[model samples]
Every structure is written in structure tokens, then in C-alpha cells.
Target: MFKHSKFAAVAILAISAYHGAAFAQDAADPVVAKVGGVEVHQSELTLAMTGLDPQLANLPEEQKRVAALSAIIDVKLLAADANKEGLQNDETFKQRVAYLTDRELHNAYFKKHVVDSVTPEEVKARYEKEIAAIEPQEEVHARHILVKTQQEAKDVIVALDGGKDFVELAKEKSTDPNKSEGGDLGYFTKGRMVPEFETAAFALEKGTYSKEPVQTQFGFHVIKVEDKRKQAPPTLEQVQDQVRQLVMRDKYVKLLEDAKAESTVEIEDPALKKAYEEVNKQQADQKPQQQ
Candidate 1:
């Protein structure tokens, strides 16, 4: 329910260090409105679009701008009145303003030094390194016909032996939801299926069906192996975003490490200091899932 005035000379954008605020500060930031000679820039309105009421995220674009404009106008009007009342000289207000300004500067620095510094080449190289580190694993491409009883499974094998199309038989007879897709299980590595099903599916020769019904907790299954191959590593396109984050996280940790080594971080509270050290140590010892 909170609105855009929260960002107009008020709270700093807390999201990604208010990344858009940097753009708002550019020269020739088009002036949309003015109050007492103070012009509201396009960048400020853009920040309000996001930092304002989060619920406005779902609103249409024009509505969001209108809402942001209204909020900016309200704040400017009250701000002018508050100036007449000499509220700007209040000590607490000045301290709060100073703190918010410092926080904004920190965000601007982070945006420049960390977020924007990561390159596409860096992300791709990291992704390649991660993929290279993963050991090759075997995978199987198979299909199955699940039925409730042993007799039904045997009948399925008999039909396969009789040259009945496995996919069509599965569509007509299988109990699994994938029956519609001719019971195709696609490709899977070991441990993805029940022990009995895995054993039966993996043992069959390519382009062959299980000669016997395989029993598992789920039910009786007649399996067919379509092919077998080493499981492929995920493509960069499939995991590029995750790899980018990994790179950024690593860069940020390095920055912190260098900064900490150069400065004295004093913790006045003993217990809090211990906890802080423990958290930092844990982070240092941890490995990202990309590895």
C-alpha cells in the first residue's frame, strides 16, 4: 500500500542498490514537472516506478507513471510547506538525510564496480570451467508400459514380441500419466527410477523390450530401451544466468576480502563479533553448486 513518495528525496532505492538512480542523475535528465523551481527528472520517475508501492508492478505502464507523478507532486508540495515550517534544520532529520545520502553513494559505487564490471566472456569462461569439472555420467533413454498386474505386464511383452508398436500399446494400456506420450520417460541417469525398474531398463539392449515384467513398489512395468549414452552437460544457454551470479558473487567476496585486510573492522560486542566471524568463515568455506 505504500507509494512512490517513499523514493522522492526520501528512502534510497534498496533494490540492487537502486541501480536506475545512476541513470536518473545523468545530465539532461528530462524535467517532467516542477515545484518551487525544483524539477522532477525522468530518472526519478523511473525509480518511483519500481521503488514505489511494489503492488504497482502489475499495473499498466501509463498508470504506473501517473501514480509516480502524483506521489512526486504530493511530496514536493508537503516538502515546500515543511521548509516554511523550518523542519529541514531539525537535527534528527539532517542525520537521517546524511545517512540516506551515504547509502545512495554506496549503492552507486556497487553498481559501477561490481554489477557492471562483469563481462559476457567472464561468464562463459566460468561456465566452461564448471562444466569441465563435472565427471561424465551414463544415462539411458527408455520407455515403459505400466499396468496394475503381472499378467498385464506379460501381455505387454507378448504384444511387443508379436510386433505390436510399443508406443501405441503403451498409449492404449499404460496407467501412467505419460501414457499419452507413449510412455516415454526421456533420458535419465541412474537413481532416477526405482531399483527394479532401473535394473530392468538399463539391462535391456538398445531397441529392445524387457522379456519379463519388472516389479516395483509402483506396480508392474514392461520397459523398453531406446538408446544409451553419456549424459550431456547442461548447455551454457540453460545455465548462463546462474553462472553470471556465480561470477558476481565470487567478485564481491574477493572485494570484501581485500577491503577487510586493509581496514580494521571493530566489533564492540563480543558475542556479535564471534557470530560475525563464524558467518564469514562459513561463507569462505562454502562452495557454490556450480562446482
Candidate 2:
């Protein structure tokens, strides 16, 4: 992952605290503090708080701003000393500063084109589209008596056929952990359980018990279907964050695709050149499936 020095980190943190409109930097940009005779603007303080330390983020808004201002002040003091010592003129320091500047620019561009550009309306539309694409699945509520031997399972089925209570028989004879609850498996869609158990359970009508034992790796099971229904789709409120991310991803991909088309990209290294072409070829091959 990428990380900034304490100096660059604090600077970005301070700048992030400022409001979007504060970028205008008119007469409204007030001096929040002075460090080593250099004024720190309100925009800088605001921007810093945007990426406050995790612990500071939970603090009240005013407290967070104060903390960010303190950090900026510390950075400014150290930066002044570094400048006095001519450290800023060092080749290594210059290179670090260049990298930090480009990373900040990249962050700003990503914020504008990817994060901030995703609107609530776009998110909602994506959520509806996702909901429309869902296929209905049948879920079953069931209970079972799992036994070590097929004879024991068959005996359980015979007991049910003899008008004995299924739950009572299950509680007495089942080896499964849910035996205490008469082996109640709750509700599950297909593919949730072992193949044999799932198949036999799903084949039975509601309120019907299996006439024969269903064998699986675990053991033999005599299952009864208590109820069945189509699984309900999740509400928008339950999936709003996921939908928003999907919308943002789609937008970012399109933005990158357009930029790639208008730009010249080359990899001079032979190994990397081959890798890059293969990567792009894979993406291009998936275009038809994605569409």
C-alpha cells in the first residue's frame, strides 16, 4: 500500500477538512492558526480533518478540527526547521516531495471522478436493476432425524408412519446436534445442505415426512418438510451501500476506458510488456460476456 511521511500525511489531513466550496479561497479563507509565523488557513484545517486519525474520527466534529490543527502546526514547525537547514534542497527530500505531490493529485482526481460523482439517484437506479435481475429461489424449513445406521433411520420412518410424533421420535433417536430441538434445520435454499439430504428434503411436500432413509456422508436422515416458500429479495435499505459501490465502480471503469482510448501507453520492459498486453487482452475478451 502507499503511505505518506508524517509531514505529508498531516498536510493532506488538514486540507481534507475544508468544505468543497472553500477551494474558492476568497476573503472567506480565515487564518485558523499561526505556526512559526506562517499562517494556517481554514481550508487547510478543514482538509486535514477529512483524514483524521481513526481515534480522532470518533471525536466530536469540533474536537476533530482542533486535533487536525494541532497536527498541522507540528508539521509546519518541523518544516520550518528543515527549510532553515536546507533539507528541502536535498535530492532524496525533493524526490519524496515530488511523489507526495503526484499522489495527492491522483487522490483529488479520484475523489472528483469516482467518489463524489456517484449520486444517490444513480445508486437507487442500480439497486433497482440488481433487484430486477434476481432469480426467485425456493427455501425449505425442515427437521430431520440423523442416525448412524440405515436401519435406525428406517425405524424412525416407521415410527412416523405409525402415527408417532416426529419431533418426539427425533428427540429420542437422532444423533445430530439439533436432536434436542428435534433436529430442526431452520430454513435453507437448495445447495445449502449435502446433496442426498437436500434432494430428499426438497422432494417432500410440506408437512410430509420421508418414507425412507436419505443416505449422505454424515449418516442416514429421515427428513420432514415443515414449510416452503420463495426467498424474498433484500430491501434497498438493506443493500444501499453495496449498490452505491457498484454504481461507483461502473462509473470509474467507464472513465478509465475513455481515458485509455485517448492516451498512448507503452511498456518498454519485455516481461512487463507481454504481461500488460495479456492483461488487456483478457479484459477485452470479457467485454462480450459483460455486455
Candidate 3:
């Protein structure tokens, strides 16, 4: 019962798009199955395949086709029986059909206006604006010698001060996996490390190691700062998809706000109405208009 309901919901969601798409080709979608004198065409089978539950979607391609065909056959048989019983004429079914039709139309409009309307130039502009707003942060390229005991960390610091190579000492004394690379942590900003370690590392000048061991949850660290510089912004290609989503969201919110302003929305329950208003208020507070 639950499975059937899920498929019905998916089919309803696809209805408008399917209808618009069905006219694109003049070639016939041959009848693949029949039930109670009702024929199921290839187009209907394709819709059924598109609407399969995610769990069933993972099946082999041929098996997926067979499963979709089976589901469509069942739907046809049950629909024919319902029609025979005049269930199609029932008021409840009529109301449901109306709601499903409106929902599908809503999806079609959203696809056309929000999804299709987004352009590459708009995404790039949004990315540039967002990137410009980010404050530059200093990042450090550092290495460390991590040891189980503070005394061990102190010994490593002594090794550094005595002009022993940090990388060799790290490989010999440190327990961290990066010890093989001389405990190289590459470049990172302050928030990336624990408070104690970050404070100690950031306090050091380039080319200096901590004279004393710094303790943290990971044990003790003999820290050094190899270099420090401003962090770089991500490449456009790396953030293009995310920026496109931001563009879509902004468009959707504007459409909803305009629609809400023109329409009457009344919640009969006072508590539910209050909750709805609060949600809208929170959304408004969280994101500023992109422009």
C-alpha cells in the first residue's frame, strides 16, 4: 500500500513535464501491455520507469524495465477495476486529482522560471560578488613534532634549537601519520586547529619553533611556522555549481514573496499561523537579497 502511494505521488509530479514532452515526437509509442481492455503504451511505460522508487532504481537496467512494466500493468488493472466500480466519480478522488494537477503545474512553472532561467553569467556575477565580500584571513604553513609526553615534545624542541632538521626529527620522534613528510600540515587558518595549538602556532614568527612544548587533546606538540600568508579564494570552476544553486534559491524566494503578496493565505489554527509567520520571518532574517 505504501509503495503504491509513493509511485502514485511520483507519477503525479511527473505528469505536467510528461505531457509537455509527449508531443515532442510524432512517432508512435507502441502498446507494451494491456489490462481489462485498456492498452499501456511505451510512453506510459517510460513514465513508470522514471517514477520508480529509489531503492528499485538501483536494479540492473533490464530488471528495472521489467519492474516498471509490472507496476504499470498493476496500475492499469486496478484503475480499470476502479472505473468499473465508479470510484473515478467519487468526490474524494476528484479532489485528489485536482490537487495533483495543480501540484504538477506548479512544478512545471518552477522548472521553466527558476531552473531554466539561470544563466552562466549570472552565476559568475554572484560568485564574484560573494567572493569579494569575504575578509582576507592569514594562513600558516607549519610543521609539528607530536609526542605522547610533554617531556618528549620538549626533547624535540631541543633538537630543533640545536639545529637538527625538523623533518628528520619528526620522522624519528613524531607519532602523527604526516611524520613521514616531516609533520608537514601544509597551510591552514586559525580556526582549523584546536584553540591551544592554533594560539601557539600563530604566535611564532616564520622560521621559528616553539621553545616549550604546547599541550592539547592530541598530546603535546613541538610547533614551528615555516611560512604565513593571506588565504586564496577558490577558483570559479570549483564553486560554479554552488553559485548556480544560490542563484536559483534567490529567484525562487523572490517568486514566492511576490506570489504571497498577491494571494490570500489564511491559517485557521492560530498556533499554526503564528508558526508559519515565524518561519517566514526567520528566512527573511537569514539571507539578504543577492542584488
**Which candidate has the top score in lDDT?**
3
Model 2 error, position 243 (Å) = 2.0
- Quote model 1's TM-score: 0.80
lDDT of 2 by residue, 132-198 (tens): 7889899999999999999998888888888999899889999999999988999999999988888
Worst 10 residues of 1 by lDDT: 8-17
Which residue segments of model 1 deviate by more than 4 Å?
1-27, 162-164, 287-291
lDDT of each: 0.89, 0.87, 0.91
Candidate 2 vs candidate 3, TM-score winner: 3
> lDDT per residue, candidate 1, 221-290, as tens digits?
9999999999889999999999999888887777777889999999999999999999988987794644
Per-residue accuracy of model 3 over 1-291 as CA lDDT, tens digit each: 999999999998799678767755424677777777777788988889999999997799889889999998888788888999999999999999999999999899999999999998989999999999999899999999999998898888777778899999999999999999999999999799999999999999998999999999999999989999999999899989999998999999989989999999999999999999999899999977656
Which candidate number would show the highest TM-score if scored against the true structure?
3
> Which residue pairs in model 3 clash with each other?
none
Backbone clash pairs for candidate 1 read none
Off by over 4 Å in 3: 1-28
Q: What is the descending lDDT order?
A: 3, 1, 2
Each candidate: RMSD: 12.3, 12.1, 12.0
